[model samples]
Target: MATTQSFFRIQTDANLQSMQVGSIMRKVKSRAWKKQRYFRLQDDCATIWYKSKKAGNAHSTCKLRWLWKPPLISISDVEAVREGHQSEVLLSIADEFPPDRCFTLVFRGRRGNLDLVAESAEEAQSWVKGMRKLIENLENMNERERLDQWISDWFKKADKNGDGRMNFKEVQDLLKMMNVDMNEHHALRLFTMADKSQSGTLEDDEFVLFYKMLTQREEVLRIFQDYSSDGQTLSCRDLEEFLREGQLKQDHVQQHSMELIEQYEPSDTAKMRQAMTIDGFQMYLLSPEGSIFNPAMLEQHQDMSQPLSHYFISSSHNTYLMGDQIRGHSSVEAYIRALKRGCRCVEVDCWDGPNGEPIVYHGHTFTSKILFKDVVTVVGNYSFKTSQYPVILSIENHCSVEQQRTMAQHLTRILGDKLLRNALEGKGSDLPSPEDLKGKILLKGKKIGGLERSLDGVVEDSLAAEVSDEDDAAEIEEENLHNDSIRRKPKKSKQGLSKELSDCVVYCKSVHFNSFKHSRIHSKFYEISSFAESKAKKHMKDAGAEFVHHNARQLTRIYPNGIRTDSSNFNPQEMWSAGCQIVALNFQTAGMEMDLNDGLFTQNGCCGYVLKPAFMRSVEKRFDPEHPEIRDGYRPVTLTIKVISGQQLPKVNLKEGSIVDPLVRVEIHGVPKDQARQETRHIDNNGFNPMWHETLTFTIHVPELALVRFVVEDYDKTTKNDFIGQYTLPFSCLQQGYRHIHLLSKDGTSIPPSSLFVHIRIKEGT
Candidate 1:
């Protein structure tokens, strides 16, 4: 019996050695002490095993908690891995044994940095090479390869039986992992469908087929067919006709058609194909090589040092609610989604909740409530994930003094050093720039005893002095009657704010608006005023130049008026033209206004901040959106776009059978006269690759203030045309020559490879 056990133990040790690249005795700082651990790199992941101290033997049991896998293990996650590093006292295990010859690995995670040391330089070098190779391989994978790898990893986890098959229970668990919650009956039906042999289990191939079914884009294929003249293919001549006039006199149209056919057709063919098949069309639509979003446009090399007021900030109103403000589900997901989409300013209406904690919700409404602490935690984690620009927490305070203090504590503790506690530039006379406040959170709300004391005191004293000067007896009687009437009306009183919470309002101290003249004299660097849409519009109409000049220096936030109960959005371009930085919108709603907002900020790297136009930024010049032709250096420009072809256009309705009548609309939004729109004639039954070869042209006076929007809609004789997909971009960013316009869903997510091929030309006009 002893001989048999010895043989088994020898075999196990041999197998372990063969599987590992290298193993070494390392002192790892697992809590406080430096314990000797056996570290090894095997199968792309690093494992640390605790050495048994009693027997001085390496154990097979590993510290499973220390294993790192892909998606989490990225090149950016590793800070440094050095060989022959000098002993660092801070991370060293013992005082006597200096780590001069040891290999040190430094990695960063959610909590903080972690350091691991190897016993010798050779062992460290081996581990570092393995880890570096793994990270590089993962990062270099294309989108399709990455998706395949993820699917394979998920399959391994789901196949619990170890026989390459999953039962109904396992399949249900897989769906849960995919975040799909289906009824038991539905899940059973799906399982049975995948289990062709009625064996009550799914094989590996069957599982893959099921996954493909879940991810297949039938709508895209249907739309492709809608564009094709023949059921199987789309002709290049038709494509050319859709992009330009059918006349043969236009040389550019013929050149564009030949170039597209050569680019999209299969190269293996003996001769250049005049048409594209479904497979060729689909591949062209989904590849990133065909993407229209220029990578150079998203580079973060722009100067972010301008004051917060100098940039147009992407702001959201009622950010806690996902639907209507009156009856919506308030969740931290709203804040997360908005921040991840590069929104810099988010509104949080805090009201008193159970216990001393405050909760965020719409007051005097039926909207659901979320804990304020949870919202802060989400903000702390995701605020800088998408963009390094500063975030503004627009707090609408309705909490009591104690609850407000608790809110402050939550912000300090959860945000830690990320919160901006004081002026970034030592209380300078001017507002600090966004660059100076990067990775910091700013609190914007009312503060205690921070109102204009001089203005308030003077008004109160004047009223008292005038009242004391009443001399005539009959006048006294008349004054008494007036006083009785005034006493009958309810008087407004100011509420006290907690000093602890008040100190957090260093820059964006919310204040009430008086008049244009008074605000000019009283507004300070630290104080910003909010105005409703109507009020702001009235100011612009009454004094356009003054309002433009005021916004050049002071920060003004314009929100939707009370009448917009449906949470609709105003045309942000009007406010942007006037240099208003924060044009807060109802992000939950989707419409033309939202499209314009998304387009304007799509430039400048989509950092949620964009530099104002030169004329709007200049203090000497006064520009008006309504009269752009009067501005100096403004000239008329003609834009010609050829609607040539579409690849994998999405069907507007899944239930409208397999056929669709698709059309392309060219919308030019700018000053009233320049806002011209036209749509091409709808093609019957073709959805896959449709060739219109029609050209549309427009002359606009102000290209700087114009947004060019490409919309794809499905025609229906019974009702209004349904929207399929759209792409919007600033006219300034439009590239000349033949280019593909990638389509985006209504919610601003890229629908891969679905694109419109067009030839765009912009020429200076009269």
Candidate 2:
């Protein structure tokens, strides 16, 4: 029942006529009204309602086409847009203007041209007031220069991003800014005409071209005839008059208005470019200043702005040697302390010591008695008991292949799952080869392609295939037959893998040849490692196997998964780019201590950081504060407990059970041995990895314990023999119950005797 300009209450009963209004209303679901459009209204006399400001123009009225359809533009948008119009228009719109929520306007000029324009009823009323203001401003602005300044200001309002030229999106945003109701597609078409390149960007010249095009398309010239005060200077109010006259019509003015607004939107390519600038890959190369494709650099430093999966600190210099102190004071403990302070990784070279131990020495001969086991122990002590991944303890094995295997076994026995413990385990079928470690937890440090065997000399390929192919249904019968046959000649084997073979083996494993994706391993290695791959391919498990690039520079092409990295040197940025899962912090790549201000201990790959004691100490000093409860509480607390496994326990399960596992024992270290011992409670029997037993839970009795320090020992309970692998947890305790007291003598003397016992040289007798 509502009519267009329904508020006008036309006195004439002009029969209703059909008006062809386009679908200009916004989609119901669009919250921002970005998809809204305009519609027109007409009557039986073709005497359409047109908005005009010719002195005493009368408001016109028309009927609705559909029975229940309401006004095209809502009242809110009309009021919002009108409010943004100049202050003078507000007063005029409030006066004599008849208001309604929906309406359409039609205008005719001397050229016999009819233009149809539509606005919400509220907008129709607002338009009359705005038109009146435009006429008044044109009349008042006697100076053309003032008018020009106003037009420039209006133009700037439409140009967003402050680039001085309106693009399609900018125009759409401008409409939204002013709350003018319009649809997106129509807005796009309107602005594209001045976007001469069709690139969706509008330059000042293009915008000017659009302005001239608008001047030609509408009957706006008469409205602005008196725009210039001195015949040379046109006021902005005159420009508003021109725009208003062109816009309020039944002609092609709406299309022209849309074209003008299209110039405000930015092109798709510009948006894509903006997205690229904010991405991780581009940010990574921003500081190095050139393509990072160099093939020979062992290590390269990256700037801080790069987007990394994890945060890290870089070494001060690219190729600094580590632990070169002349005295016998060099220790992995010192290196770890520095690492804990903040460095993510540290590197060290390994050579065979006199006892065949892998020691920290770059030279062919290992001079320092410190072994690789010592290094792993220090690192595991620092990182275990935290959610952080294992810290990288990269060992550059410069010794013979046999010695490399020895080093690997030693490291594996030391770190458990708490360190990137890489070692070539064995040469025969009984052990894991360096290559097989790719899809698995064990890291192989040497060359690939050779098959490693277990101590029993049984080939791993046959065993793996047998294990994979064996049917679970044949369990009882097979176990009986196998036990009868193997009782006479039992064998045990272990093998090791190198970084290259590991990568190839990992890639070839767990993939189907008939699938779309092919493994990226070199074809030659694929043919050679086909046996392991065949068994792995058949069964969907490839444990800790992962691909590792032979060189660091090859990381330019890899996407973001299934890889680990090891090299003589480490570049956190380059390694992360290459999709390396872990970056080995070798002591030789850079010293643990460089610039105190620079955070050298943080990791770029994962949350794990590997460090020697010295490095860990520095990190602790810098990041961890002293216990506020204690006088000088900021110092990092160190707690060490030694657990002995393989010990037998008496059985009685209580809700608060005290039964100890028969297989383990504890040795508290670093803290006052007695205090650490006092804190030891329950013993747990779980392994970190399903295959290996590494961590155990014990209760702490003291509320003030800060850090835990101790050696853990596990023994063969039945035989009472010492378990091979031992570890320590250091500086991982929070200071909750710690308290300090001044020890005083009976006479109130400040200093007490070094020994608790009083030296009773008691003059004769007490």
Candidate of highest TM-score = 1
Model 2 lowest lDDT segment of ten: 753-762
- CA lDDT of each candidate? 0.66, 0.29
Please state every model's RMSD to the true fold in angstroms. 14.8, 34.5
Tell me how far the alpha carbon of residue 394 in candidate 1 is from the true structure, in angstroms, after superposition.
0.4
The TM-scores of all predictions, comma-separated, are: 0.61, 0.22
Q: What is the lDDT of residue 724 in candidate 1?
A: 76
Which 10 consecutive residues of model 1 have the lowest summed lDDT? Answer: 464-473
**Per-residue lDDT of model 1, residues 1-766, tens digit only:** 1212222232233323432634535454433655555444333232332332323226645434333323233333454454443223222344534455355444432122334566554555555665555455545655444445555556666878677688888877776554344567977866777777778887766776666555444544564576678767657765566345322225586676566566655544512557766555545444443444444565554578777777889998888877876677786767866786788999888888998779998765678888899889889988998888899998877676678789999999999889998765454776788888889999887654443321221122122111111011123233344443222322222334666777677778776667767877878867777877777788778877677777777788888764464678898777777778888998778877888888877777678988776777666787776677777798889998888877656665555234567799999987655788998988776554666889999999878778899998888889998887899887876765456788887766555445787767778994
User: Over the stretch 398-512, how does candidate 2's per-residue lDDT look in tens digits?
Assistant: 4443555566565556654433333334412122221233222322222333332222222233322221111211232234444333222212223333332223221112111
Runs of candidate 2 exceeding 4 Å displacement: 1-329, 342-348, 364-369, 385-387, 416-444, 447-766
Candidate 1 lDDT (Cα, whole model)? Answer: 0.66
